[model samples]
Target: MEFHLEHPLSHSSLHNDDADDNTLPLPLFLVEFQHMPSSHYFLTLKSSASLLSNRNFAISSITQYSRKFDDPSLTYLAVNYLDRFLSSEDMPQQQSKHWVLKLISLSCVSLSAKMRKPETSVCDLQVEGEMFDAQTIERMENVVLGALKWRMRSVTPFSFFSFFISLFDLKEEDPSLLKHSLRSQATDLTFNLQHDIKFLEYKPSVIAGAALLFNSSELCPLQFQCFSNRICQCTYVNKEELMECYKAIQERDAIGVEENEGSSETAVNVLDHQFSSCGESEKSITITAASSPKRRKTSTRRC
Candidate 1:
């Protein structure tokens, strides 16, 4: 969709002196930004996860079977499948998480081999670190195709980024400015540095939402308000909750001293060790989702 910066005024309003005195023209940027709401973010995120899950299943299977004899172009092939899979909205949901990832990855490698080097066969994907046998990969591929009903197209995050970027009237000289801004916001989100929002798990959808929000704000103040409003309307999450999460991030980053003296590597290792203890079992997840049936599908797709 193209974003236009034109404002529409009624001829009657132009003729009426009282109307001119009482009404102010709405900003074009605000009008456009307000076209969609915040809930759109959640919806899009859910869709992305569902689509990516299939690709992951495909990739995993190919890598497992092709082990030591795996094709060199498998990675490229898998990524291609991912791109194609996410380009449309009709992707299907698979029952097993592992299956989805494996199938997508395998499809990617297969396509890559066909296009880049026709001599490459499916047997070439069997390399170490990837332990799926050829039969397993083939079975998973069949299962994925069935689950997806052969409709693999999906709209990926990259497309959303391009669409959102086009909404602003940025200058050529400041091309990198947007990237820098996005990077800064992402860093803040990841480290919990700028706000109280502490995202335990940084998913693609969350990143996309943050990127869009930050970009829109830079384009115009009204855009920020409208975008924020739209987000709220579409999502069950309230502004206050998001703000609180941002606040938690800020608080976490404001630590005065380290708990122990160690090198950076040691510090990272220690942190990882501490956080690794917080594991959740599949049964626990099932029980939790059961309590909130409305979120069951969402949790499965995302997790």
Candidate 2:
């Protein structure tokens, strides 16, 4: 496997026209993301406390259920579809049932896999425990696709890795190994932290860069500062916001450190679930919700 790590001029300009190819420019979709952010997640849930509390809990279950599937990308895409759909669509006033939400999850994951890994079979993705039939999955996917405007290629933090890595300009022997390693670490961190509502405020590119910064300190201790300095010099990135994001990642990392030092594993999960509720002024995530055709109302909380 070959990976394209070219330095793209702007994330707003790259596109992969060939269907057989899976290449995506980090910028083009990002341009759309400016107007399409997920910050409304918790606030929208606040609007209907009863609906949000119940559905958010179910959403958490769906997130866990998504683990039964093979790829993390599928979960990411499904969540993207879910968020975009809920944020924009007013739920049928009749209220939702658990099965209906499950179908939505199945459809979101199904659609996610198809978009990212086209070769993946829908039947295989259904796996054990998924109750939705092919037609049902297809129907739900249609609703989600329409809500998300068929923009299946979401602008996630992963999208910005190539461009950010290219900025470091590593000159080591087999530099590719170093770059690939850092990207892997950052990608893992991104997935782990994706459930946090706080990350919603930062642009995907900013989050991608911050993840790289966090990993570089661990993956390339000596050269990490240089990478950090280079990113800070980036005109497009906001230094203050990047540091805020970096701090949040660090706070998350601290939970691991605490566990390694003898804290209970159960305690860590509890701490993370209440992470946003911590109410630390600096760690706060605030996004005002408004009417939008494509924004999601949010259906699940990252448990």
- Name the Cα RMSD for model 2: 9.7
Candidate 1 per-residue C-alpha lDDT over 1-303 given as tens digits, one digit per residue, 9 for 90 to 100? 111111122223344344332122223222322222122233343455553344334544555544443543333234434433433243443333564455556655554444444676776654545566777767656554454344322222222333233433444477568645754454333322111111212232333345456445454444555555554443423343333332223223344224211111111111222122225542211111223342221111101
Lowest summed lDDT across 10 adjacent residues in model 2 is found at 261-270
Each model's C-alpha lDDT?
0.37, 0.60
- Give the local distance difference test score of model 2: 0.60
Name the top lDDT candidate: 2
- How many steric overlaps are in each model, in order? 64, 11
Each candidate: RMSD: 16.0, 9.7
How good is model 2 by TM-score?
Answer: 0.67
Residue 236 of model 1, lDDT score? 29
TM-score of each: 0.34, 0.67
